[model samples]
Target: MAALTCRQVGNDFFKEGRWREAIDKYTDAINLDPNDHLSYTNRATTYSKMKNYTAAIRDCKKSIEIEPKHIKAYYRLANSLKMLHCYDESLVTFNTFLGFEPNNNLAQNERTQVKTAIFKEKLQGAQVHPALRILSWANCDNDPLSCKARLLAATLEFNKGNEDGKNRNVKGLIEITEGIMLDERCFIIPSSINLAVNTAFEQNKALSPTLSVRATILKYKQRLAQDGWDSVLPALATNIRAAFLIGYMSRFTPDVRNIDQGIENIRRAIELASFATEIAPVATDDINSIDPILKITFLRTLKVHLMEAILIKYKRNIEMIDLFDKVLQLAKEVIESCNENPISTEDTISYCAYYRGHLEEAYGAIGSAYNERSKFSRGELGFQERDLKLLLESVKNYEKANEYFPSDDPKFALFHYLTASYKLMIGGCTLHEIKQHAQKAKECEKEAYPVFGNYLGDIFEKSMVFQALEQLKRPNNIASDDKYFLPQACHVSSNSEEEEQRFIREYEARTGGTIAATMDLSQAAARANAEFLRNGISIISSDKQ
Candidate 1:
């Protein structure tokens, strides 16, 4: 009775926007009736309105304790958890509320928003396709944060996939950024970031838009000059520069001059970030909901870029060992910092693992290339033995990389393809063993084609197609000679076949809605035959003419 009176007064105070008065009334009610769940929930709502998420969460938990199935308390708790960046916990609470009130549109919408938030967080750490699909889902409320997140996500995806198809739409990111820039709260964020992303795609260098390649760096610099640098801006600049290096260096041939310029910019960005940290005690505190650990993440990513750039310059050089060791030590230190205060997402962990894996792969590849060159340049002995050892090492490192990424990630396709290539080059392996690995690599590459839209997978698949064709036309090489023998004793053929079929089935099931038909052996065989016949007919027609 007294509790009811206090709640009524609290509601009046809340309606009048007197948050503290409402909190006082609710507190009085809770003291009078310690088990009054309504009082606790009302107080929680007041706390939430004040943006005191921690206090709100406590009150909501108390309300839920009094009544386990309290729907409002569950909702409030979920919102508070979300505000605190406890996404997984908030998701569970949202699910609980939805389970009880199945038809609540508001709850359903909130659940979708929470799911979007989770996807956004996951995307930041790693490239997850399902997360991208959810980010692109229709019916999402016009949430500013979600909009910004989706823009960034789409930008990444477009950068990865745009090369595969010219019709791919990435303009949405720029358009959304343009809209968001109109809001005073959002005006501080650099709009050129997305615009540059869009322009980079236009220049067919989306993978790595160097400052010189695309005017993105110029725009970013201009924006910084106009807006002035904040504690977060330096870190963001470092990230932008690192991204450029990764994309640019991944090319078949990178320009050393451009790399040097990008490296200088990254170093300057790092110095700026250090200065920001020195000036601000709360340098790593969350700014506008962006993670404070970005400075370290950017620094770590920059180190990786530097390693890659240096590797490119010295990959085939005998003196590369000293530089590689220094970079590896620095990367280890950056990774140690992450462990102590972990700012980056699982994606960053995977990114670090990928870089380490690449380092190992680079060492093995460079060593093999150097040994091969030594035969001509330095007259080194046992080049063949060193080749096999180096190839094996490369395969093992790539496999380790695969383990770090998700099972179906397109990135693993490169690892598998490289492994297969090395296995074939290793020699002494049976025809069946070599063929099985080659086929596995081809299939993995083929499956990844849609995501990255790159020709590397096509290159791998073509290698298998050529092998398969050679087996039919000329029974000379391992692939051709091995066609007659299905060495069951080896188990590689049977195991790889089963794995391949399982991968195809899983891919089909997951992409049933999006993909009309998946490529298979039958299609590949038919295509190969058609090409052979066309070539034979061309020869016959030329002779007749």
Candidate 2:
């Protein structure tokens, strides 16, 4: 009874963010019931929170010794070890936790992170054969995150003309593309770029070229030859460049919501995709080759980008009906193409359905924005009753997309996250529904990370939950004259230097710009390939030591 009272007090202190008080209370509980694993684990957690990792590790190990199955103890121990730079021990402890809770994606993600840390450390120590290290990660209990690592490693190996490289590279290429189609801003881009560079450099060197790394890197500047058959590598590179451009538009554009540059970039991307398709010349028998997936991603990406641009353009010219119809046509084509494919995966089908849902959602949002234009001085469009009707249509399409994923798929989490966001915007959700969806979205992210790995799209899910929770905090009786949706502001800047400066300031203020600075967003295909090759080899070398 005394131990229980102390533990309860400790939990309350912990919840109140009084770490030192919580630790004292937990220590009192441990003194009262020395064998109680919970008391020890709780104290260990408090220590971890206090950044006393050595003491935390000691307490966690004692708790684990008392109760081998104590999951929380394992977690605290691993986390503390990781903080202490005990990468190998942390890796083992995480594996121990997974032995009992195999399906815990949170644990899986943590473990993958530890593994990556270990890999980077080893690479720094001049450990050669990156493919071998990647294989170890890939074969780790058939975990999806490890499988992705293996695919990337194998692709690099194949680029070096190592045995088993051809088959692994082909398979890795396919999987990486699939990952990009699902979400563009994952770790897939960097891995794929690294692999492509090694392969291209090696191939270039074999053709009357020296094996020297410097000579190989120079090959990245050379243009790809116009082969009669459109090989997968060149086509894949085009798609990657296109995806990067779209991301650049979103991230680098002036915050005044100016999207003219974005629109031009999208047009250029579409032209690149079209040219790649024409040059590839797929035979009837090879229809299943990169053609279907590449075509589908290009069309869907184009539709989404075009719709965003159209929404911006619609503010200036309400008569963008023709352009809107064209985007709608693109959406339909994506859906039809997915259904017609003989080898389409369930994931592909779900993606196509999700794309269609976005089309409907965008249409509804634009209508709502147009209707609420009176709220802003720049909007000349008038609202109609049909605009509300379109919003309802948007909700229904989102629900339909959710159905396409079923419960087992990772993408299902994304649908729930998006649906919750839309529901919040639509203003009809009860507090209970909002809470239910927000929690489910969080759980879904935890579930999906082991499968798809973390993505930039997950930021939207986090924002949706944050916004929805803020809405829930407001009183029900609250009333405001503000419109639910308004057209974006007009940002017309003629001076390129001023526009660039404004964008840098706004973007840094919004996202802190630290991570953005680290990401390589080169527009030139040859340059990206070359840079990766130069850095890839240098990641681990004897001379570095």
Q: Pick the candidate with the highest TM-score.
A: 1
Off by over 4 Å in 1: 1-254, 274-295, 312-386, 427-447, 454-457, 460-545
TM-score of each: 0.41, 0.38
Candidate 1 residue 193 Cα shift, in angstroms, is 5.2
What is the lDDT for 212 in model 2?
A: 31
Residue-pair clashes per candidate = 2, 0
Go through the candidates in order and give each one's C-alpha lDDT. 0.50, 0.50
lDDT of 1 by residue, 1-545 (tens): 98889989999999999999999999999999999999999999999888666678889888999999789999999887776556678888889998999898987898888899877766664343322323222222223222223333333333323332233334433332222212111212233444444553544322233344235445544555666556235434334433443333333345656655555554544544454344333543443243332445435544544555555555545455675555446545544654554432334332222233333333433333333332222235312223446456555656555554333344455556655545544433333454555556557655444333343635743454334323332112224322322121122333455654554455456556233144443333333333433343221111110
Query: Which window of ten consecutive residues has the lowest lDDT sum in model 2?
Result: 481-490
